[model samples]
Target: MQVHEIQVRSILTRTGGFLREGYSHTLNPYRGCAYGGALCGLPCYAQHSVWITSGRAWGSFLDVKVNAAEVYRSQVNRERRWAATRGGLRIYMSSVTDPYVPQERQYGITRSLLEVMLDEPPERLVLQTHTPYPLWDLERLRALLPLVPDLSVNISIETDRDNLGPGFPPHATPVAERITALESLRKAGIPCVAVVAPMLPIEDPREFARRLGAACDRVVLDHFLLGDGSPGGLRTRRTGFPSKLEEAGWQQWTSLEQFEKVCDIFSEVLGADRVQKSRHGFNTPGPGRCSETTTR
Candidate 1:
């Protein structure tokens, strides 16, 4: 992977379109995702964003915002002032790239951003990723709990099966390992959430839901057709994801029928109050808030 240390003019971006509902701003420490070649990136809607990619191949290059923390420190106060007039500031750590990607171990950009947030906490903060790298800052996260009014860690586990067959890029974290990370975060008294986005082929839905119930406070279930951030999943259709699923003999999962079935199964196991769907689920209040089941 080609890594570039570039400086960004801004670290916090105003949320709109897909993320407009719950969050006031979004913070991405990096431009391109290191896991862009991983399993999750196959159907990633972010890859289709030409403005961010700038014609670079997904996963082939990574632009690290070396001064992300500095930029955030400078702009956060002004942004917070602006947000206060409109609504309380709520920041989503990342929307396009994983905050805990592997490069984070060396650069510490995400860690630095969190440190700055410690000094200037937001009304609400959500850290979302599909990797176990968050454990690197467990103590730091614990320190922020009392400081940040609302804080939650969202871990995406798309499927129960660890392997999705050949031709797919290797996952950053295996299924079992990700669940273990969630367990650790929950044990640390951190608010944890399991995001099963674009629900993949699961060997057993009940067991999967049960596992998630034990690991996190609540679960968000979604399918590409409903949650791909496009009208009728137009962007996802442009990828080979559908064909890959079909080749794996899981074509039935390409439709909403299986997704709905899995949602019902999840509700049955995790309780309807704990089960949520798509954008509505993501926009729901942060951890420790009352739970409401979204209509499937």
Candidate 2:
């Protein structure tokens, strides 16, 4: 893997495209994801963007935004001054990159940004990752929570079966580890959510939901075809995921029927209020400021 330290003009970006409806802004400390070659990449819509691809294959390289924290401070101060005209900032820690990838242990770019946020908290902040590195800053997250009441930590664990992950992307964290982290965070009194994104084949749906309910406050279920940028999951189809499933005799995993069944089981186990389906979790409104913020 090749790593480059690149300078960026800005850190915070007004959420656009598919994310606009969910978040007001996005702060990606890294340009590309280290999980690029992992199962998560199979359905990642960001990989399809010409801007990120730049003629290079996904997950083969990483560009560290070296000045992310400094840029974020400037953006936050600017936003604070215009708070009256604008609206409370609900920033997603990352959109296209895993904020806590292995490279983070060396550069601490995501950690630095978290420190900045500690001083000036956003109205709502969601820290999403599929790795355990974020646990390194458990105390920091706990401290920042009091300042930012609407903060949430979402761990993206696609399936209970870790074996299936490497078949798609070679480097994703094990599903069990992710669930353990989720349980740890919840135990620490941090608001947590387990995101079964691009919901993969599970050995047992009831057991998965029961485990998730015990680990986190809520659960979100999504299918690759629904979240993929391509309508009807054309992007996933291009990757031959469906064909792979058929060959593996797991063809049922390729259809939305499986996703719907899993959702129903989750609702039964976790309670309908705690189980979120499709894109609903993203659009769910946080307790915002004293005004109605336009999600779009």
Candidate 3:
């Protein structure tokens, strides 16, 4: 068997205030990610993660954070005392590494953390993953449903194409497959938020939001091509998906205000009933305040 490895500083990072509220602490099962995505934070993975940004991230390498879950469990347990006395505890899963990548099929650290949350009961456990395949650990989600009721899922995807999958490393499930998995989670009564971030300029963004909203309880959109040209996010999907954004040359919007103008346009085109449009991005077309309940 081939051995893959990487080195890193700390596993998780607490960045972005207010938005990063509650789920500041994070955990990654693997040191590097398998479904190497461009936006991923793993600086070691060459496909996406941090490698492509500046070649600082090594390519297609694996650094199995051996004591990943155990480490988190110990630390969280320690913090529980203070958390209980002070206010609440919220831990974001897989900030640097995906908590449910293929290797998880064997290690099961994410599952273990879920179990811990069930036993200890954190005020919130925000689970985020790019993979659409829903690994339903029902016993856990159900157990903490009441206490950690703030559990939010951010299933990230760029395009809903089966072939336009990520251009990263060895990941089997395609975009369509992930969409199904996420839908399954929703059917099982889990609150799931689909994040179409790094929104590549492809596949009629409006239509994409409509279709995704149909499947998920909520939708969140973010721009991807903020002037970073790299060759990383091709493992599970494709890269050129962003070219469509570059080619179309959207309507007149040059200054920073142009983005808000685009969001207004998106709200108009996608429809507030079918696609909720906030200054943030697209969301489940609903009457409720969207971003507050959804984003982590």
Candidate 4:
């Protein structure tokens, strides 16, 4: 299959309007995604409006957005000029697809993108990924980390039952397996923040938060239920259901009195300084931020 090199110097121009607004720009080396997540259909709303035709749902096909980096450099230059004039880092790696999906391993689009970002002075860079084991090119990430110091790696781990068996396919690995990937990233000094997103239906929600919180530098919470009321909603193998272990009222784990009840769990376990929650405003918003209250 021949890879198409499309030039998009200014990738994320209006992506901020949807979610992950903090990410002003995006650089997807590959067009489609490999994760094939259940909720993957939702966050992709902004992109779907333009690319998707049928509208049933976003398809999973990796069309290497080849010329992505060149255009990205140009956009960065323009954004830098805009930042110098207006002031602000503008851009996000991904809004629709995973920046480091399987296709990245071969084409190395992300690797090349890192080089370009490192060549410059540095700016605000936010990365979101379902897979955490990104050591394919350690030297590059390490080198770029210092230059792009404002980088925030959001590792997406929605629930404890990531193993993908019952309803989930075999392609996706279990959530437990990827948790350590975050640990490896933090150890690499890459500054990882766990995205406890699309919360799944797990055996225990409280313990799930405690465990994932312990691994990453910080935690961002996001609900799994998209609230679209669509059938065949997100599910798992271990529990045969979606994971919402970290949500607000699920299982009544996090006390309603105050957000502190939830924040304190990981804060006390992970560290008062590290553990974060959405309602608290003081803590980081785990991997996912479904709660419209604070995030919106």
Residue-wise lDDT of candidate 1 within 7-33, one digit each (tens)? 999999999977778899999888889
Candidates, ranked, lDDT:
1, 2, 4, 3
- Per-residue CA lDDT of model 2 for 1-296, tens digit only, reads 78999989888888766666666788899888888888777667678777876877888888999998888887787765544244567788788899998999999998998898898888778888988667888888888877885888889988888676334555388788888887788767777788888787899999999998888878888887787657888877877777777777788888888888889999988888888866777656532221112121
Question: lDDT at 15 for candidate 1?
Answer: 94
* Tens-digit lDDT track of model 3 for 1-296: 12244333444444343234345455565655665533332222224444423443332445566554455556666666655654456666655556667766766667766776666666666677877644557557756667674666667765554433344333235667667766666665676666655443334555665566656666655443231222233332243333433344532221224434444555565555433322233212122223323432
Instruction: Give the runs in model 1 whose Cα sits over 4 Å from its true position.
Output: 289-296
Backbone clashes in candidate 4 total 30
Regions of candidate 2 where Cα sits further than 4 Å from its true position: 80-87, 165-171, 285-296
User: In model 3, how many backbone clashes occur?
Assistant: 19
How much lDDT does each candidate structure score? 0.87, 0.79, 0.51, 0.53
Candidate 1 has an lDDT of 0.87
On lDDT, the candidate that comes out on top is 1
Model 1 residue 95 lDDT score? 95
Candidate 4 lDDT, 20-95, residue by residue in tens: 3344445566665665444443333323444622343244445676676676676676666655543355455675
Model 2 CA lDDT for position 63 = 93
RMSD values for the candidates in order, in angstroms, are 3.3, 5.1, 7.1, 7.8
lDDT for 68 (candidate 3): 49
